[model samples]
Target chain A: MNRRQFLSWLRRLAKTAAAGVVGLAGSRWLRAGFLGAEAAPPAQRPIRPPGALPEARFRAACTRCLLCGEVCSAMCIAFPSRIEGSQPPLRRAPGAMERQELAPPVWRGDDTPYILPWKRACNLCMRCGEVCPTGALRPIAVDRQTIAREVRMGVALIDRKVCLPWTRTSWCGACLTACPYRQRAITVDHQGRPTVHPEHCVGCGLCVEVCPLRYKAIAVDPPFAPDRGAVRAE
Target chain B: MILRGWLSRRRRRWPGGARKVQVLRRTLQLLVLALLFAIPTLSLYDNLRNQRDEVGIQSRWDTRLVHRLVADLEEPKALTQAVRGSVWTFKAGELVISDPLAVVDFVAASRVPWDRFLITALLPVLLSLLLGRVFCGWLCPADLLFELAGKARNWAGIKTDVTFSRGTKTAVLAAGVVAAVILGNQVFAEIYPPRIVGAELYLWITFGTFGAGAWFFLALIAFEIFVSRRFWCRYVCPGGALYALLGRYRLLRLEVDPVACTECRLCNVSCELGLDPMGGRFGQDCNNCGLCVRACGHDALNWRLGLPPSGGVDRLGHPESGVAAATPGEPAP
Candidate 1:
């Protein structure tokens, strides 16, 4: 109503405008932390299995309760979006990585290394687990994201050309039975040795778990040093 | 007319001395009832009206039982004004008898403003400690509901299924505390046991689907209608349990006048909390509804405010007789 009050109002308006700009800019910038481009390439991030909690329990169990997000020692547990009908599709099971991009085929890949980068890993302090009342992640559970498991022992390769099922007319469905993602994710090839489905296979080495062969035909290639060859091309 | 005539005839049948006593007791009963029922509403109404006018406001009354705990948590700076907001915000030497968090959160958030925390949490506990669950029997809304429930039970021919156990309430209290600690300060306000189920419903309906503020309010009425009796207060309320423990050693308590009672079973029938007010452990979970007093066929039972005996109930008067036999003096509880 008065001149001084008007000036004070103007000051408030200016401060609010500045805050708005900063807020927008901050959101845009933080995308680097969240998005697939800067954080992990879209394919590398892992998948969260379906039907974790119904949409209601997700929100009912929380009041924006504590600053679980802010207090998190490891940034693995962040508040899910408060958007309209955007709660779930959260992870039902505990895996190494979470999918950043929610496009086709759900999440990226487990143990892809970038999904949970070696440095930015969950410390298993149970801060996130303890805080969640709905038991999304139990405080004490065997199915947890452990840093030790993801270290690459070697690369695994299949003899796609000569595997009995893929090459010939025999019904040798050995590999399909052994695959871990189970329920026949690995298809029977022409001879029926089993051809790998890239979508289903997460390179967990479970198919290689049971290969009944003399020299262990389906095996991991041990990681090697380039200097072991001792050759100088230059 | 017929009922009034019947009651009048019943009175006439009694002795002249007892009839004279009945008239006096009835008048006293009416006044006490008005204080118990009417004044709380008036206090609320006047408190609101005075707030709008700001000139002829009632002098500030403090009931700071829990407010002191909340003082250190939320606003340590504006303690005075914050304390001034609730009637329970009385100052004391390094201690306040108020649920400060409730008052602080209510006044501060302005999101979910309620007076129940101070009234239910602070006032009842202090009164219970001083006068032993006076509010439970006298003033609280939940206790009021429980009285209605007792009548409803009789009408429906239903009986309580569970025997008394403090386990459920103790667990609820621990859970509320742990949740508050894990969640946030006063985060337990969701299940505050009187807000009580309304806020939880509000959270469920509002957050789970297409929710709005109004829908949350709708959740409130729906919950109040469906929730059976004082289930929350009796079994699950942390605040009620706290008051129960605090009032354990209270100086003044519900005393039986042995000289007065006619064994009419009116005291047991009148009690909303199902306490045999004439029997031992009369104060346990007694909401002090005074229905027992009103129900007395004769002016037998009165909540005589006196210091509890040295051996507690041993020195107190009983109802089965008609003369005061003890020393004409109050003994310490």
Candidate 2:
């Protein structure tokens, strides 16, 4: 072959090699969970909307259409603007425009819908799933049985150290009154201290919103949270 | 041949078809813009109504008009639920439509047809196959924004003549697909302007804030203003690339009338994508927006229904170079 043709062949070979290298690196990254685990620890991970797929699958499935947030009646769902770390829940309201300017984390889909239950929890209305075209959030029926069975967003845990009833400061059954699952998810003892049944709790975070404490004695933790598992196991 | 003749005859018979198409395109563009704002506004009203019952608080914003509009409809449930999602993945009840690029990104990343992705993707795929990159011209909200940005640049006395290879878009598409496959995430949806515009608008309307995607979108607008004209759609839109590829052999193509032709170059100047309509060099890039057809003072450009010609529209001015060459019996009118 002439020198020109030889050079063209060499160029083609180099391009193929470069493409191969990129493909290899991408696969390694995917397998290593570069887009998933390394970005945020389990504890730092934001609470996903109800009926959402597991973190990895949700990231893959969600096109970040923002429909879930649009349909949220409580106006609870929020998309993180920061590239690496999500802002604290209470901080979402103030200076929203400035928050939007923050650089998003590199590896994550920036449009995924997350809820800050302490500020505005999911109403268990199941509208987000109905509107989610991607099935990132499975369309769960609004029935109590179906929501309780299918939805496992997280579980509510009461901090005895801070809770008024548990601390013997006052008779507080705010969480029990606010719990959607009522007797099934939360119950009060003779002394009127509210207890959370982790197995029955759907983690809707109604208790967290109505805790009536400055620090919020009751909070929702992801079902896989290490401390939650330990508490359940214990 | 008979169907082609009838179609061409109908187009000719439809008085002012060229101008009508442009008007229709603008109307559709405006309709899409209206829907983008309206859908989220209605949802906001619905959400706030629900909030009133659940949270025992009055909705701060007044939505009396939205309530009246919804109240006028006999059945608002389907209207509310069916008409959701952004431009990336629009759902009209059982008929879920998605952008072709989003579909490719999802499939490449997940390596699975999760949910109704394949079904949702089918309509846009078919649309591009028939009409070419019509979405970029007719319905993309970002297209409207980019055009306004271009006009603003003109008004501000900013001149940007920068140009890049059209193939850059295809390369970007390939790279995006590869990156998505490796990263196991939808890459194009994260950055595509049309999707970003829709998602950002929804965020702003519903939550009174924009996502980081809004900043990215604004940066793109700024780039278009300062660096290139319609930069994303021309040189680097992976979605536009996918649409171009899918619509490569589209049935409807822009044709120039050789007989009535005055090489005024107005059509070329009118084309947003920098395609050569004066020379009929649109190839697979003409969005069938019909802007060139409307721009022709000589009334030389019109839509033709058939497969793309073997080598682009026959060299602009040659007597035997246009549709007449293909259908021998039909002389130039």
Candidate 3:
């Protein structure tokens, strides 16, 4: 995204952050001190699975494509604007202006994970790596394979108005054509726009790849739980 | 005031005796340096021997009896010392180096700054060992620069002497020593005056350590492009003069016959160091690049089978003719 959109997103993200902190404080106070009459929101609605190992593996795979950053419903993942070159942890910046390798240092097949700072701290979304053709990131079997947890492209969100599947209006099915899912998560409507099935959405954000809009109709989004907010690192 | 006046007068008279005196002075300097270098070398031999027996490092010169004699002369302190140095290849690290102390000393008090070490090492050796001093004829970053500058200068119709002060290498050596003392190990480490072996240890070490090594390499590349006549290899090079000095005393040296010289001056024009091979001095900086020898249409400049008829070979032993046509110590005539 251009600087203007990035700034706007930052502004919107700041407001979201403030609202989240207030909600977290309210919920914690009610659950502990107030009577148990009030039904509280499920703090841990495990999405996909007990995905600790898989999430770490996904982080390893995600290249921090702004596709995921743009699609994040909760916008939990924060892409760093700057980091020191010396630190190994901050070395991975998504969209860094240099070529990168996938699994570097050991698997030396055209290592593409480097120079692109987006390589590190990906929020279990394989969108950026998927966008990369250089194998800086790889296509992995995220769920079904039961072997190693390879990063699958994270959640793809659809804008109901623009997306053909959700809006029930006439729209093209190009995003449906782009997505790798067999049971089409997105469907076209009578109008020329796209529609999304939230229950079926795996959050791969491949629709963003074909989406003509700068902020894709279908894109990857980071996990949003205010209690387990992302720990900002230098 | 007195020194300036004397230098001005001497500069005006570029006589034969002055040239001979310069050669003699350089030879003396070489002798001193050889002695200095030998002391550490012998100690290194002993270290190598010890390492062979205990540390499993095989010795190349162990069987040679001369090593024992050389080892007797070295001080104990000159054996185990390590200093900041760069080796490019994994082979170098594996080879069980015999001269750690000497290499350390050379790196620490490098006759040239770390940046210019390549020239500093190669230059003095070129002058002392063979007359073919053009590392660029074989290996030099400055040669690349000079090639660029020569094209530029030709376009501009400019011709300036690429060669300059003879003692400039000594000054460079002194500069390197001082620089090393002031700046800890890595001063001007990248693109040093020595033979850059392979990937370079400096690059590997400096990546996570001192940040300057990477920048120094970039700067050196830029200097190589912009500098006129490759001044980096010429005056600024500390090792070149040391090599020139060493070349004077080297077992093998270049000599010429004035009687045979048609004085075509092709050799002069072709010389990368700007040494006029026909200019009577047989230039200490002469790397015997043999451009003049090749350029000679007169068939005059062929390497002699042995010493010249004039017996100048006695003055410099194991003489090498310009064309490598000459034999060693030809009859001592």
RMSD of each: 23.5, 14.2, 27.4
Residue ranges of candidate 2 with Cα displaced over 4 Å: A1-45, A82-109, A223-234, B1-16, B51-62, B72-82, B113-115, B311-333
Distance from true position, residue B306, model 3, in Å?
A: 7.0
Relative to the real complex, the DockQ score for model 3 comes to 0.01
Give me the displacement of residue A39 in model 2, in angstroms. Answer: 21
Rank candidates by DockQ, best first: 2, 1, 3
TM-score of each: 0.36, 0.78, 0.34
Q: List candidate 1 segments past 4 Å from native.
A: A1-83, A86-234, B1-125, B149-151, B182-187, B197-229, B312-333
Residue-level error in angstroms, candidate 2, position B169: 1.2
Better of 2 and 3 by TM-score: 2
Poorest lDDT segment (10 consecutive residues) of candidate 2 chain A: A34-43
Residue B313 of model 2 has an lDDT of 39
lDDT of 3 by residue, B11-52 (tens): 974534324543554454344333333333333343345445
Per-residue lDDT for A79-189 in model 3, tens only?
221223321111222321121122122211111121111221222333333322112234344344321233322334444444444445444677777655524556655
Q: What is the number of backbone collisions in each predicted candidate, taken in the order shown?
A: 27, 4, 73
lDDT tens readout by residue for model 2, B1-333 = 989998988787454767788778889989998888888877777776665552322343435566656657887665555587768877676677888788788788777955476777887889989998988899998999999989867754568668887888989999998998888777888789988888877866665556667668878978988888887888899988888888887888877777787767788888888787666567667788887888888877788898666554322212234544432122211
Model 1 vs. true fold: TM: 0.36
